[model samples]
Target: MSWLVTGGAGYIGAHVVRALVDDGESVVVYDDLSTGSAERIPEGVPLVVGSVLDRSALDAAIRDNAVTGVVHIAAKKQVGESVEQPLHYYRENVTGLQTLLEAMASAGVGRLVFSSSAAVYGMPDVDLVTEDTPCLPMSPYGETKLVGEWLIAAAARAHGIRAASLRYFNVAGAAAPELSDSGVFNLIPMVFERLEAGEAPRVFGDDYATPDGTCVRDYIHVADIASAHLAAARRLADFPEGTALTPSTSDAGRAARSGRWSTASSRSPAGRTSAGHEPSVTRQVSLADRARELLGWSARHDLDDMIESAWQGWRRRHG
Candidate 1:
């Protein structure tokens, strides 16, 4: 079966495309090249340079490519930017899904895997989120993602399509040597880039309740996330009689649905209120559980390993 990967030229989507190709799966990429780079997608994979919001383009691409499954990853993801431009977030994240769903119905593609986010949890009161937490999204970005998941569920129930939403946390690390995100967002990469430039890596928020006042986060390697998507796709295929829809198995998404996982802080790279507070290590191990139960997957690389490997890769590519 052919897979249509929206935003396949962006960071996480690019890695997913590479993984699918490596596993001998056929892939067709749909990206507008707004934030996605043409060079980021591996050579030879078909690319449709269009937006997911454009139903005509989406329908044509899905039909021409014979795309049986879709992995929707095209959405505006910057929390701060979403706050600054809520309309843009709603238009891209919410309306975009509606357009894709309409196109999918028209084209007869019955299965979908959506890339949701842990930001739906906002700041919870509990540290470890299960799959049943009440959603309290803080930013327009998170709200859009939550709404996207809701749309998937609604469409599935109404149209008899099967779907799985994969909620992701701090998605870091690179899968291919040639594919690196040069974006200035995200803390780890920002730290690496600054340190590489011989500048002190800035840490944010040193005055919270944790050991290190800096906000603690559950960082998952992008590769593991891709594996989860693959598993979700497989599960949807393997389930008997076709289950209508299910939320992501990730802890944060679970918490959002069940109101169990709570506790949040504004995570930024430029340092929070204080510059000298101790680091607050994340206590949630949701992704690990997902790796075990959902995909039979395990993160072979830790944060330090990912950092060092990326550092070397950056040196090789840039230096």
Candidate 2:
């Protein structure tokens, strides 16, 4: 079946496209190339240079491609920048979603996989967050994401669409040589870039409440994230015939009935200090609870393995 990948030229979107191609799925890419690169899209996929805000463009793409489903990954996603420009954030993230949903309804495409964020949890009171976690976004970026999910839910109810909002954490790693570089907004790429420049990536705070005295986060590998999207898509394609659910159907209704969670082992608490007394910088391994249970997904790359591969890629490309 043909799939529409919005933002297919961006970091995660590009990888998802590659994964779909590798799975022998026909794919079409739609990207405005604001922060995305046309070069990042694989040569075989049909590419449309367009924005989600343009309902006419989206409707034409969907009708032309006979798009069976959509994986919506387009949005402005810089946290600090979102704080600085909240209106633009709302327009791009929220209003743009409105445009996409309307076009999807007009085109009669119902299944969607939304690229959501752990940022929706916005620095949760607890370290490990579940899907049920209260969304208390601290920044405009997070707030817009929360609003986007709500809009998707509303659209689904009103329009007979079913969606999976994958609440991703820090997505890192690369898929192939043609894949794009990690965006400047993400920390792992920033760290790798700084290190490539022969500098130690700065650690932000070393006095956090975690065992290592640094903030810990769920660092998910990009390949694993792609796998989850595919799984969600397949599940949507195989939905039991004649279910009358409209778009308002909760995520619990159409896809991801359960989840799988796995965590990379945390660094030894003993590694908290180097001889210079700097706290050991580390992020928590994501427990793949939802991916495993709901989508039958689990992560293949652990933190150490991901770091090694990222460093290797950086060295090969820049050295």
Candidate 3:
């Protein structure tokens, strides 16, 4: 069956599209190109340049392309920006998802693979965040994701839709240099930009009670994200209608879903904070236990691989 991938031209989206195409899936890209690039679309994949908010366009794309499933990745995804522009985030993320779901229902499409986030957990105090963890999101972006999951669940129950939500954190690295992330929002790219500017990488928050007095974080490779999406997409068609699942991690071993993975000062390239305080290191193993069992998916990249690939991408773009 043909699949429509929203935001397929973005860094992560491009990688997801490539993974799908490489797997021999018939694909179509639906994007507004706001933060996405046209150059990222695969050579043979047809692109429908439009916003997810436009239901008419979405309907047309699904109908004309014979889409039976969708991988929804288009959203306003910045935590800080979501705080500053809550209305915009709610509209674009929440409302945009609603519009897409409506279009999907109208077009008789029942399979969906939604891109959720660990941000929905919002700094949980537990050592491991399972699917049963209470999703107490702190920021607008995280709230939108949690709400999006709820929306997907509601639709699944009422409309016989089959869906899955993939929750992840700290996406880094790329499958290729050209597919690398161009934003400086995440930890790695932020460090890359700071060092390139002849300045020390800045680490925020110094009040955590951890060993290094720094907050802990979990990281995943973008390629892993794409693979998880691929796995979810392929598995959805086989599940019974109204079935729903949420996979919390990708690849590695057991992920550091709980707080305080390690001493930050030694684990990352941003060795020391500007004030000479020790930065924290992440303790990510691979909390994707559910993903492995449900979709037979696991992350292949490690922390070092993530950093090195991202470094390669930075050099290619900045040099």
Which candidate gets the maximum TM-score versus the true structure?
Answer: 3
Which stretches of candidate 2 lie above 4 Å from their native place? 180-182, 238-287, 316-319
Q: For residue 86, what is the lDDT in candidate 1?
A: 100
lDDT of each: 0.72, 0.69, 0.82
Ranking by lDDT: 3, 1, 2
Q: For candidate 3, give the lDDT of residue 101.
A: 94
Cα RMSD for candidates in order: 6.2, 7.1, 3.9
Off by over 4 Å in 3: 205-212, 251-286
Model 1, runs deviating above 4 Å: 240-291
lDDT of 1 by residue, 11-86 (tens): 8889888888888889999999899888888889999999888988998999999999899999999998999999
Candidate 3 structure quality by residue, lDDT tens digits, 247-281:
88754442322212122223234344445544433
lDDT of 2 by residue, 26-87 (tens): 89999999988888888878899998899899999999999978999999998889989999
